[model samples]
Target chain A: MALVEIKNVRKNYGTLEVLKGVSLDVEKGEIVTIIGRSGSGKSTLLRCINALETINSGEILLEGQSVSAKMDGLRQMRQKVGIVFQAFNLFPHMTIEKNVTLAPILTGKTDKQGARKLALSVLERVGLADKLKAYPEQLSGGQQQRVAIARCLAMSPHLMLFDEVTSALDPELVGEVLKVMEEMAAQGMTMVLVTHEMNFARNVATKLVFMHQGRVWEQGDPKTLFANPQTPELKSFIGHHAG
Target chain B: MRQFSFSDLLFLATALEWTFLMAAIALAFGVPVGLALALARTSGSAVLRTVATALIELIQGIPLLGLLMFFYFGIPVLVGKDVPTVVAVGAAYTIYTAVFLGDIWRGGIQAVRQAQWEAGACLGLSWLQQFVHIIAPQAFRIALPATVGFLVQLIKNTSLASVVGLVELARAGQMISAGTFQPLLVYTLVAAIYFTICFPLTTWSRTLEARLNGAR
Candidate 1:
C-alpha cells in the first residue's frame, strides 16, 4: 500500500490558484524527487501532503487514514510523517539535544533521560552528537541543517518531506545537507522532496516528478525521463537546466 | 505650618509599600488577561480577534486617569453603593496595564518568525502546546524589554491612584509638602525615591535588550 495518497487536491490563495487538481502516491521506501521552477506549486503540493497548506477541495490520506484538522488521532498521524523546511527552523533558544528530544517527550511521553538517550543517537546519525550541548546559533549553517534532519529522525517517522532543504544554504554548505539526505534514502527511508538540484534528482531519485504551472507535467523513472524528454515542456525544462 | 519632621519623611517612605502593592495588583491582574487578549487578537477566529482588538482600542483610547475617575467616582455614584477607593484604584490600574501590556506582547509574538509555528505544527504538536513550548517562550524573550519597561511605567502610573484618594508615594509627597510648606524639598525627595525604584528597572530592561541582540 502507498504510504501517502493525495487525491485531486486543489488549493488557492485568495484569487491566485496555486495547485490545480494535483494527485500522486508514494509507495513505501521510495525516494520521490519533485523538481520544478519557483511558483510551479511543487512546494505547495509537498506542504499539502503534510497538511500544512489546507486543500480548498479534495483529500489526502496517510497510511489509509485521512489527513485533516478534524481527523481522529491527528497527532499520531503527524508523528509518523515528519517535514524539514528550506530554512533550518531549529529553536534558537534550545540546545541541539533538547531540539531533538522535545517532540518525543511531548508526543510520546518519553522521559527526560530516555529522550536524552534518543537525542544522542539521532544526533549521531546526522554527525552532530558532539554538538549536543550547543545552541542553534553556535552552529554553522550546514551543521544546523544536519541538526534539523536529526530532529526529524528522532521521531522515527515513516515518511519524511523536505521542502527545498538545500536552496537556502551557501553553495559550499549544500553538499553536507545533500549527503545527509543521500544517507537517509540509502537506509531505505521514504522521502518526498521538492528540490532545484537537477543532478541529485537525476541520480538519487527512483521516481522524478516535473511540475509546471501547478500540475505534474511529467513523471517516470529518473534515468529514462532525463534521457528522453516526453513533452516539449519537460524537454525545455531539462534542456534549460542542461544548457 | 508644621516643621518638617523625620516622622513625616518616614511616612512618605512607608507609602512606597502601597506603591509597590498597587503595582503588583495591576500586574497580577493585568499580565494574564493581557496574554489572553494578545492570543485572542492573534487567533484565527475573526470574532475573538475583533473583540480583543476592540477592547484594547477602547481602553487605550481612554487615559488611565479617566479610568481611575470612572471607577472611583462614576460607578459608585451611579450604583448608589459605597465602593472603597482602593478597589476602584486597583481595578483601574489592572485594566490600564492589561490593555497596554497586551498590545506590547502582541508585537513580541508577531516578532517571532512564522517558521517557528510551522516547525512546531510539523512535529504534530497541539496549538496550545506549540504556544507553551515553542511560540510563547520565544515571544516572551522578544517581549522582555518592552514588558519590563512597561512595569516601570506601571510603578510611576500607580502615583495616578492619588487622584482617587489612595495615598501612595506621590500623594504622600503632596501631603508632606502641604504640611511642611517645603514644596521643593518634599517634591525633590519624592522624585529621588521614584528614581531609585525606576532607574534600576530601566537599566535592567536595556541589559535584556542588549543580551537578546547578542543572542541573535
Candidate 2:
C-alpha cells in the first residue's frame, strides 16, 4: 500500500465547488510536487491530508488505515504527518525553543527536560542553534520559516507537507529556505510540496502533478510530464512558468 | 458653609475604602466570567456563540441603573427573599462588569492570528489544551492594557452604588454635604478623590498598551 492515498476527495464552499473528486497516491520516501494556478485547490488538498479542512466526500488513507477515524486516531496519524505553511506561524509570545518544544510536551507528553533537548536538537539540524532563545518577531522571515520547519521536525513525522513555503519570503530569502528543504530531501524525508518554484520542482520532485480546474490535468515523471505535457491546460501552465 | 471638618474628611476616606472593595470584588468575579464569556463567543458551536452573544447584548442593552434596580427590587420577589443592599448592589455591578469585560476580551482573543489556531490543532491538542497552552498566553498579552482600562472604569462606576444608599464614596459625600450644606466644597473634594484613584491607572494602562504594541 502507498504511504498516503487520496481517493476521490471532494470539497465545496457553499455553491462553489473547490475540489472535484481529486485523487492521488504517494509512495514511501517519494517526493511529490503539486503545481497549479491559484485557486486550483493545491493548498486545500494539502490541508485536507492534515485534516485542517474536512473533505465534502471521499477518504484519505495513511499506512492502509482510513484517516477519518476517531480524533485520537487522527491525532496519532498527524503525529506521523508534519505540515509547514507559507506563513511561518511560530508562536509570537514564545521563544524559539518554546515554539519548537510546545507540541512535544503537549501532545508527545515529553517532560520539560526531554522536550528542551529535542527542541535544541531540531534547532541545530535547522542551523538555528544560536536562535533558541530568540522570539519569532526578532528573527528574519527566512529564519522564522526555518524555525517553523524545525517545529514540524521536532514531531519526528515521517511524511512532511509544505504548502507554498517560500512564496511569502523575499526573493533573496527564498534560496535559503529551498536549500534547507533540499537537505531534508537528501536525508530521505518523504515530502509533498505545493509550490510555484518550477525549477525546484523540476529538479527535486520524483513526480510532478499539474492540477487545473480542481483535478489533476496530468502527472508523470518530471522528464516526461514537463518535456511533453499531453494536455493544453498543463501546456499553458508550464508555458507560462517555464524558465 | 462650615469649614471642611476632619470628620467629613474621615468619612470620605471610609467611602474610598468601599469603592476599592467594590472594584476588587468586581475584578475577582469579572475576570474569570469574562474569560468564560470570551471562550463561549469564540467556541466552535454556533449555538453557544449565539447564546453568549445574546447574553452579553442583553446585559449591555439594559441600563446599569435598571440592572441595579433588578438586583435591589426584583430579586426579593423572584427568590421569595430579601438580599443585603451591599450584596445586591455588588451582584448588579458584577453582571454589568462581566458583559463589558467579556466584550473587551473577545477583541483581545481575536487579535491573535488564525494561523495560531491551525498550529495548535496540528499538534493534536484538545480544545482545553489549545486554550491553556497557545490561545491563553497570547490573549493575555493582548488583554492586559484593556483590562486595566476597564478596571479604571469599574472604579469610577462604583460611585453609582451611592444611589442604593450603600454609604460608599458618593453617598458619604452626600451625607457630609447635607450636614454642612456645602455641596460645592464637598463635591469638589469628592471629584478630587476619584481623580486621585483613577488618573494614575489610566496613565499606566496607556503606557503599557503602547509598550506592548511597540514590541509587536
Candidate 3:
C-alpha cells in the first residue's frame, strides 16, 4: 500500500471550487513536488491531506486507513504527518525550545526532559542549536522557518508537508530554508511539498505534479517533463519558471 | 466651626479600607466571569455567541449608578426580600467589571492573527489546548494595559458605592466636611486620595505594555 492516497477528493470554498477533483498517491520515501499557478489548488490539496481542510467529498487514506474527520482518527493522522506553513507561525511568547517541545509534552509523547533532548537534537539538525533559548522575534526569517521545520521534525513525523515554505522568505534567506528541506529529502523523508522553486523541484523531487485549474494537468519523472513538451499549460507554466 | 483632626483622618483610613475591600471583591470575582464571557462570545456555537454578546451589551448599556440602585433599592422591592446594601452594591460592581473586562479581553484575543489559530490547529493541539497554550498568553499580554486601565476605573467607580450609603473614600470625606465645615479642603483631599490609588496603576500598566512589546 502507498504511504498516502487521495481518491477523487473535492473541496469548495462557498461558491468557489478550489479543488475540482484531485487524486494522487505517495509511496514510501517518495519526494513528491506539487507545482502550479497560485490559484491552481496545490496548497489546498496539501492542507486537505493533513486534515486542515475537510474534503467536500471522496477519500484520503494514510497507510490503508481512510482519514476520518472524527477526533480520534484525525489525531492519529496528525501524529504521523507534520505540516510547515509559509508564515513561520512560531508561538511568539515561547522560547524556541518551548515552541519545539510543547505539542510533544502536552500530547504525553514525552516528558519535559525527553522533549527537551529531542528539541535540542532537532534544533541541532536545523543548525540552530545556539538559538534554543531565543524567542521567535529575535531570529531572522530564514532561521525562524528552519526552527518551524525543526519543530515538526521533533515529532518524528512519517510524512512532511511544506506549503510554500520559502515564498515568504527574503531572496537571500530562501536558500537556507530550502537547504534544510533538501537535507530532509536527502535523508529519505517522505515529503509532499507545495513549492514554486522550479530548480529545486526539478533536481530533488522523484515525482513532479503540475496542477492547473484545480486538476492534475500532468505528472511524471522530473527529467521527462522538464525536457519534453507535453501539455500547453505545463509547457507554458514551465516556460514562465524556466531558469 | 472646626478643624479636620488626625483622628478624623484615621476615620478616613477606615473608609479607605472599605473601598479597597469592595473593589478587591469585585476584581477577584470579575476575572473568571470575564474569562467565561469572552470565551462564550468567541465560541463557534451560534447560541453561545449570541447569548454572551447580548448579556455583555445589555450590562454595558446600563449606567453603573443605575445598576447599583436597582441591585440595592430595586431588588428588595421586586423580590419582597431584603438584601444588604453593601453586598448588592458590590455585586453590581462585579457584574459591571466582568462585562467591561470581557469586552476588552475579546479584543485582545482577536488582536492575535487568525493564522496563529490555524497554526495551532495544524499542530494537532486540541482547541482548548491551543487557547491555554498559544492564544491566551499572547492575548493576556495584549490585554494587560486595558485591564489595568479598567481596574483604575473600577476603583474610582467604587466611590459610587457611597450612593447606597457605603462610607468609602468620598463618603468619608463628606463626613469630615459636616464636622469641619471645610467642604473645599475635604473634597480636594478626597480627589487626591483617589489619584494616589489610580495613578500608580496607570503607570504600571504602561510599564507592562512596554515590557511585553519589547519581549515580542
Interface RMSD of each: 1.7, 1.9, 1.3
Which candidate number maximizes DockQ? 1
DockQ of 1: 0.65
lDDT of 1 by residue, A27-144 (tens): 9999999988889999999988877778899889898888876678877877888899889999988889888888889986578879878988889889889998898999989999
Instruction: Give the CAPRI rating of model 2.
Output: medium
Quote model 2's TM-score. Answer: 0.95
Model 1: residue A180 alpha-carbon error in angstroms: 0.7
DockQ of each: 0.65, 0.56, 0.63
lDDT of 3 by residue, B1-216 (tens): 789889888988899998998899898888889998998888889999899899999999999999999899998998899998767887898899999999999998989888888777766778898999999999999889889989999999888999989999989999899999999988898899999999999998898888888876
Q: Output the worst ten-in-a-row residue range by lDDT, candidate 3 chain A.
A: A68-77
DockQ of 3: 0.63
Error of 3 at B174 (Å): 1.3
Q: Which model is ahead, 1 or 2, in terms of DockQ?
A: 1
Record all residue pairs in model 3 with backbone atoms less than 3 Å apart, i.e. clashing: none
Error of 2 at A165 (Å): 0.7
Q: Select the stronger candidate by lDDT from 1 and 3.
A: 3
Error of 1 at A21 (Å): 1.6
Which structure is stronger by lDDT: 2 or 3? 3
- Candidates 1 and 2 compared: the better one by TM-score is 1
Evaluate residue B20 in candidate 3 and report its C-alpha lDDT on the 0 to 100 scale: 97
Highest-lDDT candidate: 3
Can you tell me which runs of candidate 1 are displaced by over 4 Å? Answer: B209-216
